[model samples]
Target: MPILTCSIPLLLDDLTELCIAYLRDSLHASNC
Candidate 1:
């Protein structure tokens, strides 16, 4: 349970980064 708790934030951070990158790419593509 402790390991799971620790990994949750790391997983969320990775997901947030992925979402930001995806959004940036989408905006750039639309601009072009």
Candidate 2:
């Protein structure tokens, strides 16, 4: 449980970054 708690934030951060990159790519694709 302690390890899961600690890793949750890191998982969220990675997910957030992936979402941002995906959005950026989508925007660029639409623009082009």
Candidate 3:
């Protein structure tokens, strides 16, 4: 198996979490 595929999911999950956190932070900031 390739190391790239093994890490791809983790990378994607991290990116998704980052985007979600950024969006949540912006939304909460707007409410304040």
Q: What would the TM-scores of all predictions be?
A: 0.64, 0.63, 0.63
RMSD in Å for model 3: 9.3
Quality of model 2 by C-alpha lDDT: 0.65
* Per-residue C-alpha lDDT of model 1 across residues 1-32, encoded as one tens digit per residue: 33345445566776666666776887899999
Model 3 agreement with the true structure over 1-32: per-residue lDDT tens digits = 23334445666766666666776887899999
Show the colliding residue pairs in model 3: none
Q: Worst ten-residue run, lDDT, model 1?
A: 1-10
Q: Rate the local accuracy (lDDT) of all candidates.
A: 0.65, 0.65, 0.65
Model 1 lDDT vs. the true structure? 0.65
Candidates ranked by TM-score: 1, 2, 3
RMSD of 2: 8.9
Clash count for candidate 1 is 0
Off by over 4 Å in 1: 1-11
